[model samples]
Target: MLDIIYKYQNLLANIDEYIEDSKFKKEYLIEQLGVSRATFYNKVKKKSFTIDEMVVLSTILFPEEAKAFEIKEALRQSREDSKAGKTRDHKDVMAEVRDKLRA
Candidate 1:
């Protein structure tokens, strides 16, 4: 759960960086994401977003950053799997994460 919370915060920070670097307004971003202002705010506040929603936002907002984010997420998941005593290949987990990111 803490990992998820951290991931959520990191994702938000990445979005903020993109917005700042590109001088892109949040309103425009929300529009591009097809999410209303209120809905966007609510999702951020609740930290409740589906992977598909996140992929859409990342792909639209900062495609380059999305690659970095996917790599980080894959690493984190791999660590978690190891911690849980799940015997799985890190490469396999990374492949799965990559597949999802591509989707």
Candidate 2:
């Protein structure tokens, strides 16, 4: 799966275009993300996104073609995450905290 994405990095670089233009008619991406078509559509329903989601999302949506600068930045970020002892997104973090608080 990753191999296929690497092969189509150029195309993925324009994922936003593909998604917007065809309403994410691209089945490969939908499948690769392990998300249902409804999940994709749900995101489309939103009018805005958190800045962080925008960053990782751009990369996830374009693993190959995510500009050299962005790819370098993301790599540096992942390294930083490793050094920090663990890695997870803000949404995951908040969910955990919220669950603990509820408990």
Q: Give the top-scoring candidate (lDDT).
A: 1
Model 1: per-residue Cα lDDT at residue 41: 76
Candidate 1 lands at a TM-score of 0.41
Error of 1 at 78 (Å): 28
- Write one digit per residue (lDDT tens) for candidate 1, span 5-102: 89877986565454556656778767877888998777766656567777777776677887888899999998999899977688999999999999
Model 1 whole-model lDDT (C-alpha atoms)? 0.76
Candidate no. 2 TM-score: 0.33
Model 1 per-residue lDDT at 85: 96
Give candidate 2's whole-model lDDT: 0.61
- Candidate 2 lDDT tens digits, 1-103: 9986674554445545646664334465456555677775565465233345445455555456578768789899989989998777899999999999999
Total clashes in model 2, counting residue pairs 3 or more apart in sequence or in different chains: 0
